[model samples]
Structures are given as C-alpha cells and as structure tokens.
Target: MATPAAASDWIRYWDEASSDYYYHRPATGETSWEQPDRWICGEGYDSSEDSARRSRAGSSLPLEDEDDVDAPEEDLFVVRASLSGPPPLPAGGPPPLSLGAPPPLPVAAAEPSSAQREERRRRVLGEILSTERTYVAALQTLEKVYMVPMRMVADAGAKVAIFSHADLDTVFLNLDVLLKLHARFLERLEQEEASGHFGAILSGAAKDIKGCYTRYISNYAQAEAHISALASKAPDKHRYLEVCKSHPDAGGLDVRSFLIQPIQRVPRYRLLLEELLAHTEPGHPDEADLREALARIREVAAFINEETRVLEKSLVRQGRAFVREGELTKVFLFSDLLVYGVPTGRGYVQKGQIPLGEGTRVERLPRTEHLTHGFAVVDGHGKGYTWHGESEAETGEWFEEVQRAVAILAMVARKTALEHFTAAKAGCTLIKFNHRDGRSSPRWVRISADGSAICWGDTKSKECKSMMALSKAVALMHGAKSAAFYRAQGAKKDRDWLCFSLLFRGRTLDFAATTAEGLFTWYLALAALVGPRSSEPILDEEALRARVAEMI
Candidate 1:
C-alpha cells in the first residue's frame, strides 16, 4: 500500500479544507457528507455568518482562530479518535480530516501568588497578616461561641450573670478594633509591597496598633477584676460554664486562657518587629522607621508586660466550696487581694475582698467532710476564711498558688517602694543616727541615700517619706555647711560621728553617720545620686557600688 500521508499533512489539508465536511453523529448514526452547505451532523449552515450567530447563541462552539472559520464546525468533533494511530485512509479518498488533539488540560497553579514567600519587612508583614487572622478567629470564637450565648441569657432577664458582660464587651470591642485594624494594615502592606515606602507605612501602622491597645492595657486590672467577679459571683455561672463546656470551639479552653490571648497578642509586636528589624539591612530605606517602630513597640510591650502580670496573678478558680460559708463561694486570688463573690451571669457579686500581703497567712484546714477539701487563709486584716476544694490535692494546690501569689505581691510591693524611691533619687538605704523631728535624742535612722527621704522606725518595719526630689536634696546637702552637720553635737558626741541636717519637706531632719568612712560612704552615695557631677543619678545598685568604690 502507498505510504499513508503523515498526520501533519492530513491535519494541514483539513486546515485549508472548505465547507464540505463530515462528522460521526453518534447519536443519530447518520452523516450527510455529500451536502457541501450542510454540516455532517445534519446541522445546515448558509454561511459563516449563520454559524457565527449560532456559536454566539451557545448552540455550537465558536472557532478560536479565523483560520478555522471555513472548516465545517462539526468536523472538529471527528478529531476525538485516539491519536495513538494514524487517521483512516477513508476508502482511497484524501486522508480523513482530524482536529488537533484537545488542548492539554491546564495545570493548576501551585499556591496563590499573593501568599507566596516574602522577604524582610514584607515577610514580617505577611506574618502580621497571618497572626491578625488568627487573633480575629480567636475573638470570633470567644464572642460568638462563648460570650454570645451568655449575652442571650442576660437579655432574657436571667438574674445570674454568666460572665462579666461589661468586661467581655470591652475585651471584644478592643479585640475587634485590633482585628479590623490589622486586616486593613495587612491590605495596605500587601498593596504597597513593591513601593519600598512600606517602612513609613509599617511604622504608622505599629503606632496605631499601640495606640489602640493603650486603653486595653491600661484597663487590664479592671477587666481582670470583672472577669473574676463574674466567674465567682454569677449565680448562673454554672450555666455559663456548661455552655462553655458544650461549645464545640471552647470546650477545651480555660476562659482565662482564652481571654488572655488578646492581652498577650499586644506584647508580641516587639518580638515580631524585632525579628523584622534583625533581617532588615543597614542603610536600607526602611531601617530608620523600623528602628523607631521597634523602640515604640518595645516601650508599649514593657508597659503591657506589667499589666499582664497583674492580670495573670488575679486569675481565680471558682465553684469550690467554702467551709466557713457552708456553701460554694467563688474564690479569686489576686496578687494583692483575695476576693469572695457570688456568681451571676453578668459578673460576680463580690461578697468581700481580703488583702493578700506579707501579713496574710494561708494554712491547711482539717478535712472534716469526706466529700470536701479544706484550707484557711488569714488575710491582711487577720480575718480568717476557710474554704474547701474538691480534693485534698486541689485544696493544697490552692494554698500553694495563693501563697505563691502573696509572696510575689510582697516582692512586688518592696520593688514598688524601691522604685518610688529610685524615681525620687533615694533608692539606696544608709544606716545613720538621726533625731526624730529634730529631737535631742538620736536614734539609728535609715536615711534614703539621696537624702530625699528619711525613715526611722524598726529595721524590720520602716516608714518611708518622700521628702523632696533629688535636685532639691542636693541643694540641701550642699546648703548645710558645717562639719558638725556631719558630726553629732553636744556632750554625747563620739569620734565616729558625722552629722548632717536636711531640710526635708520643710522639716529639719538630723542624720549622723557612725564613722568617717561611713559618713563618706553615705555622702558619696547621696552625692552620686543628687550631685551635679554624678553620671548615674539614680543611685541604684550599680550606682551605689560605683559610689562605694569611689569612697574606698
């Protein structure tokens, strides 16, 4: 047999062929191959115009290119025969026409280009987008799945407030603000990726976020108190708890943990931005703005960290029975206070709060009821409260946690006192002899190293007074010009005495150092803190160390 025409040659012939075309009308089993004006499928066309019109009406597919217009449209369907074999010879006529194999199925794109990997600030911005999406999801979970049901109960005139409606509202409101704001910022960041001006844009966005979080951070304590109140005092708290337990989204969550996520998210900016800054190259256009943003974000993070600590310490585990009250009372153990409340759906109706402090005491109570676990806490007032947990282990845990919280509060109170002194330039303590209110009798005084304040009570417990700022104290220290000012006067004077008088808060306060070296030690410490030559004026531990070294 003569060599069959190559497939390309047959396809070329079909490409140039006119209206005389044929197709296998599989449905009707008929072909009108003799009619030049009729498509082989029994669809007749007068001209290309008719075919084009029908194509537009969706009756037939339209030709993709003008070159295929003259080829009878039905002939395209005849090309579906497996291309594995050559087209048939068609009984000694020209090789049968065939449409090119159907275009290869399009390969789906990998991942969307918008979500592709990014670099530098752009990558961090993408992270921001991702985290913001997560934060919004969390907010939605709390608001819709948890708070919404509680709110519905409240609206129905349920006297028992399941949660602190006000606190949740505030948290939800602020969280929504952050969520929506971040979303907008994410959009801007994405849109401006190629602009290279995103440094300023990102800085502005960070500042706005910090600003928005300011209220939430500042009011964190109140929010924590409210949450504890609601969890403890809400008469319908169990109902709320039941709902939370049954919630598909919140079943495994601790309400406090879920609620604190938003609080925690605020401080995370520093970490995220620091990473972005670390990756950013020096002298880059965004470097300055990124640095500034990092500074501001760090400041805000520090503040938020402090507030977060308070919130964390205020956490309460409720629904435990009170041995004293003979019923279950919500127990909120805060850093500085322990509160008892009745649970309501809206919030806890606080029965009372006992200050937790150095004076407070926690002890295990005798487990009288086999069903109950017990502990006793003596608050700062020395008033005793006995409570029960579900088990011995549970009550022990409560005691430990409360004791730990109280210890932390004690440390914090001390630190706060020192911080107050540090701010006033009197952080360091110096043992000296002093007369109370200028009385003749001299007693050992712990003069604030900066001489800004004085304390003269027992070493175990002392009262501190903010006499003046360090600046004024410096002037007073210099203004008093007498060796006797550094030495005790009268017949009671001793060789080790170095006395000084400070006009503190318009009252003359006398101080006498024990020895010459001790006098200079006190002098140098105060001078380092309040003196004009002092580089580090705060007289903190490092400053005190440096000052003592100078005296040596």
Candidate 2:
C-alpha cells in the first residue's frame, strides 16, 4: 500500500486540451491516464490532509476525504472511465458519486393540522369582524358628516344654495336605509363570531341583504350621475363637497367614495366568506352555515350581474305614437325588439311585439295629407304599417331609434346565425319538432355537417330517413293564414299555435313546436342556415356562445 503522503499526492485534474481526467502524483512528479487505487486516492484522508493536498495542487480538482468518498472504489473507477473529463461540479459541492448516505431524502412540506386550520378560520373570521367595524364606521361618517347636515338644513326650509332638496335626495337615495341594514347585519355577524360559531349570519340576513342591496345598487348609477352633474355644473355644490371632504371625520374620503363603500362592501363579504370556507374543514360545526351564507351571497352577486346585463340591453326609446291612425299606442323600441302596448292607469299593457331582425325595415315618409311626421314599418312579410309622431323631432327621434334597434338586432342575428351554422358544420345541430302532416311522434332534425342539407328521423333511429337539400330551401314562421291552412288540413289545434313551413323545390314541409318559444327557436336555427349571408366579418365562436348565454 502507498504511504499516506503518496496517497495524498494523488491529485485528480481535468485536462482541457485532451478532454480527459488524469491523476498526478506530486511525490514522484508523475502524471498518468489510469485512476489511482483507493489507498493512493486518500481513502482514509482527513480534511486537513485533503486541504493540504489541494493547497499544493492549486489548479487540480479537489480530492474527497474518507467520509466524502462513499462510492465503492470500483464504481468510482467506472464513472471516471466512462467520462471524457471530470463531471460538472454541483453548486453544493463536487458531483455526486454515490456519495455518503445519498444525502437525506427530501422532507415533504407538512400539511396543516386540523387545529392549525381551525386557527386560520378563526383568524379570517376576526379579519371579517374588524373590516365590518371599519365599514360601519365609514357609513356613520356619511350619515353624520353629510346627510344629517343637509337634511337638517332642508327641513328648516332655508335656502340651500348648492343643490336642490330633490337633488340631495337623489344623490343620497336609500343611503340611511342601507346604513341601518348593514349595522344590523354587522351586529349579527359579531354575535356569531363571539359565540365561536360564526355560521350562516349572511344567510340569516339574506332577505334584507338582497332587497336593500338591489335597491341601492340599482339606484347607484343615478346617484353617481347626479354627483357628476353637480360637480361639473354647480360650483357651490363642488365647493361644498370639497369642504366636507376636509372635515376630520371624513377620513380623507370624499362623499362619492363613502357612498360607494356599501357597493364595495357587498363584494368584500363574498371574498371573505370564500376564504373562511376554504380554511374550514369538512364536518366542522361552522361548515354548513358558512356554505349557506356563501350561497346567499353568491345569489346576490348573480342578481347584480343579471340586472347589470339587462340594464346594458335596456330600452333605447319609448313613447306615445299613433299606429296607422289607430288608437294611441305606447311604442317601446329596445335593442332587439319593438313592442307596442295600450296605455293603462299604472303602465302599458303589452299589445304586440315585432322582432327587429334581417327582414325588418323602417323608412321616413314625407308629410302626408292626413298624417304628420309619418313613418312606416314594413314587416318581414313586406306589409307596411305607418306611425305618426307628435312632432318632427319626435318622429325623427323615433326613426333614428328604430334604425339603431334594427342595426343592433341585425348584428346579433348575424352572430347567432354564424354560431348556429358553425355548430351544424360540426354535426351538433339537433332539434325536435312535430310534423304538420299528422305524425303522432316528434321528429329529430339536424343540419348536415357540411350545412348543405336538412336530415330528419325519429330519435330511436340512428340514421335519418328523410333528407332535403338546403341550397334552395326557404324557411318561414307561419302567419295566421298559413296556420289556418294547416288547421284546415287536419293538423291538431295545438299545431296552429307554433307552426312554421319549409318551402323547397315547390314542395312545402310544415313543422310545429310544442311551445311558441320553441317555434321561434327552430325558425331561427333554420333561417340562419338558409338566410342570405351577411357582409359583416365572422364572429369568434366562443364569444358568440358567451353572447348567447348573456342573452338567455
């Protein structure tokens, strides 16, 4: 066996020029291609001996001490023989070589115990309580710092310079009611939290929360608009607001900001409840209650979302107008439909509805001998009905609103059409309809994958027995006359309610739906495939699907 000094002298170094590892014996000043034996490579060397060896051979790779070199001697030889040069050194130390005990297996992160989760849930509940206190305090500031002062002034019948009493009422609509509602809400939440069983506090307040928040959120837009108008058009109002904002009790937030706190608070409750629910474990005492509360909050959120969507697609214009010199009518033009109704003591009783789609038309007519400010609406069947506005401006406004509704309706129709056509192309278009030829069972119909034909069969059959080429097909929802004809042909009375006809190659195929809505839906699907193509760019299919969902 080599002596200790000679063993320490065996330095392993990588040669860059030759791309191989070589061992150098400093004692004999000899370098060789062969790896030295375990004894010569310092199998029993200490740190100090290895350090001394490294100090002497400054440019060579450091030798491992006895504790570091855990690999079998033969394995180390095999690793070195296979490699062209010394392996890359890892950041922690030299390359692992079956190293001592293989470094302890990585310890997985410990999962939070039930006790820890309970602690986290309590902490979240505490956060919610603290935030509620802060919110209630803010609402109080709005009530005390602004609303009370303004109301007192108005009640004294003093000349309030900045804004009218009505304006103030509009700007702070239902705010006091909301403050009282949330104060009670906060008290109940506090009671539950104190009892260490914060369960269903929100669900318990579901009725008041939904009613009050819906009223407040619906009127929030009017409140904001009133404030914005005052700020821009009323200098005294703007100065008064600035002065009130400087009050110490205002906490650096303006009146508008304080007013929005309730709006913001609603959504914050949702998030906090969700976080608390997450930290809560199954079968915990609070779990069921917490879930119920979350559901109620989510219901409120959904109501708000739906109301916003409806408001977005609300009426464009509505007013009194004469229909072809008929009885005075209330005409309401919406984004996608035109509705006319008979005026009642409270509101309008709806009389009729016309969908403003591809075949709908509106035109301004020159002042007629008997009708002033006259315009005509040609229905999808090319029949014209005239209306007279109260004045030229009213008539012009009606014309413009009708034109806008028509354009918007057309865009929506094109998008729906493209979506239906694409779904049919993907072999997904399937609808069930009753045949007017006295078939006892409803037939399943689908547009062909290439959108060239319509196929029909019973649901029990895997294959369609009847197919019609759509290239020359025309689909129309049946009018009263056509329904009368179908009824005379021995169709059921229910068939007269939701009947439509498909005319192709001089042959007519009549179909009916169980419901009137189903009649319109089927007509729309068929019309989309067979209707004249639109000039607008194709809409994204996913976006169209979402749009359809919103419309629904």
Candidate achieving the largest lDDT: 2
lDDT of 1 by residue, 215-247 (tens): 766765554444445434553664565457445
**How does each model score on lDDT?**
0.47, 0.55
Q: Can you give the lDDT of residue 2 in candidate 1?
A: 22
Worst 10 residues of 2 by lDDT: 316-325
List, in order, the clash count of every candidate structure. 24, 0
- Model 1 gets an lDDT of 0.47
lDDT by residue for model 2 over 1-552, one digit each (tens)?
122334335555444334444555555566565556532322223234445666774624333222211322122211232334334332443333322211111122123446757887887888777767767777888898889877766675656445568977787888888889779978887778766577766567665777778887777666755564454356687677777766767643456656656655565577778988878988987788788888877877776666555644543211111112123367755445667888789977888777677589899888768887888888788877777877788788778767755653544343222334444433322322323323333555566553446665534332353566665564343422243344343443434444556665445455555543344445555554443221121122222223433333
Residue 402 lDDT in candidate 2: 75
Residue 150 in model 1: lDDT: 65
